[model samples]
Target chain A: EAAVTQSPRNKVAVTGGKVTLSCNQTNNHNNMYWYRQDTGHGLRLIHYSYGAGSTEKGDIPDGYKASRPSQENFSLILELATPSQTSVYFCASGVRGPDTQYFGPGTRLLVL
Target chain B: GDKVKQSPSALSLQEGTNSALRCNFSIAATTVQWFLQNPRGSLINLFYLVPGTKENGRLKSAFDSKESYSTLHIRDAQLEDSGTYFCAAERNNNNAPRFGAGTKLSVKP
Candidate 1:
């Protein structure tokens, strides 16, 4: 089975604070994604990487940035966190598009 | 517009009963994936299909690309199966998947 892990299971940040959520996958998958889950919005993709050193924007890419330094690590960065960004974030890895994706536990962020 | 819509936003079932969850898409979906978000907020992949049906244990899932819909059937529900189920569809190889709002299921003893 694929293993995906996220760091800082819970975070509380002040407005305008810089926050970073880390994700690591052990399956050596080429595709990694970052998503935020809201109460009524389900999951919205923020960013995704096709491979190391590659990042692409998704539906809701504003107020967020992504970095993939290696095949095993992908990170989501919020240079200026806001209350609107307070939601549960998930990380997923897959071998290809439209395929089974393994998701991490999730990170709960509260921006005040 | 909602590209992917899920039916029965919420559901309650008695243990040992059967239920079905459905998702309809407005886009040209080529593949579908189903996931279960547990109470603790872990999303587990249940099935991924390419216009076919797959069964595992008491759960059976079917995806019809031509019909632009998918269904998940759970037989003999258990408390452990209580969670929010989400269905996602991919229009093509280069497109990002669109996710449904999810169906929350509660199995009571």
Candidate 2:
């Protein structure tokens, strides 16, 4: 099984605060993704990276940014957090082709 | 409109029963993947398919690319199977998979 880990399983941030969610994968997968899950919205992609130093916007990327400093690490940054941004975030890693993605436990964020 | 839509948003089943979840795609899906989100909020990969059917233990999943649909069948459902089931579709030219609204399942003893 591919190993994916996320830091700060739970977070509480104030409005306009800077929040960072980190993800690390040991499987050496080239593709990594960040997604947010809401009650009605299943899983909406925020950003993805094909490799190190590459970041691409997804369906919902307006208030989020991603950094892939290394192949094993991907981070999601919220420059100015808001209440609407409070949700569970998940990190996933996969290969470049039609391979299955392995997900991390996920981080729960609350912005007040 | 939803690119990938799942039927029966919620379901309740008794142990030792059988049930099936369906996903319909409006996009030209090339591949499909199913996942189960447990109570602890962890996504577990259930099956990945490419226009074919695959079975594992009491779980079976089938994908038909031509018809743009996928189905997941659970036989003899158990309490441990209670969770939210999600299906994702990968388009031909898109690298990102579009996910459907999950089906929340409750298995009772």
User: Which candidate achieves the best DockQ against the true structure?
Assistant: 2
- Runs in model 1 lying further than 4 Å from the true structure: none
Q: Top model by lDDT, which number?
A: 2
**Cα lDDT of model 1 by residue, A19-104, tens digit:** 99999999999999999999888998899999999999988999999999999999999999999999999999988755688899
Q: Per-prediction DockQ scores?
A: 0.71, 0.80
Give the runs in model 2 whose Cα sits over 4 Å from its true position.
none
Q: Estimate each model's TM-score.
A: 0.96, 0.98
Question: On residues B25-48, what C-alpha lDDT tens digit does candidate 1 reach at each position?
Answer: 999999899999999888888999
* Model 2 RMSD vs true structure: 0.8
Model 1 clashing residue pairs (backbone): none
| Tens-digit lDDT track of model 2 for B1-109 | 7999998899999999999999999999998999999998889999988899999999999999988899999999999999999999988767778899899999999
